[model samples]
Target: MSQLVVEWDRLNHEIEEMTALVGKKDAEMALLKAQLAKAQTEGPGTEEVKELRVKNAALLS
Candidate 1:
């Protein structure tokens, strides 16, 4: 019975650790997605920005 209790405790601890790890990973993924969206909106490179500006100027013309 004591041995069973010890095994159960070990299993419970493992589950809690896994749960915390999963939560951390989820938060990290969310942060990465937000960063990607921001980067996309901001235009990632000089060429992309220049292209967008040129397109805007052409449209205005």
Candidate 2:
């Protein structure tokens, strides 16, 4: 029926939007992981440590 077709189209559109959002989140997580790794390797200074703490808190929320 036409109503079913409309519902199917809406669900598909929602799924596509969610998929794109997930991709963006994946990229952000990768970048955050890379930054954490780099900071660990370089040995964080006081300011860097503070910054990292702020970032950690933000992530926890």
Q: What is the lDDT of residue 61 in candidate 1?
A: 100
In candidate 2, which residue ranges exceed 4 Å CA deviation? 44-61
lDDT of 1 at 37: 93
Off by over 4 Å in 1: 44-61
Cα RMSD to the true fold for all candidates:
6.2, 11.7
Instruction: Give the candidate number with the greatest lDDT.
Output: 2
lDDT (Cα) of model 1 = 0.95
Q: After superposition, how far is residue 31 of candidate 2 from its true place, in Å?
A: 0.2
Q: In candidate 1, what are the lDDT values of residues 1-61, reduced to their tens digit?
A: 9999999999999999999999999999999999999988886588877999999999999
TM-score of 2: 0.70
**What local distance difference test score does each model get?**
0.95, 0.96
**Which digits, one per residue and each the tens of the lDDT, describe model 2 over residues 4-56?**
99999999999999999999999999999999999788986889889999999
Candidate 1 is scored at a TM of 0.71
TM-score for each candidate, following the candidate numbering: 0.71, 0.70
Q: Tell me which residue pairs clash in candidate 2.
A: none
What is the number of backbone collisions in each predicted candidate, taken in the order shown? 0, 0
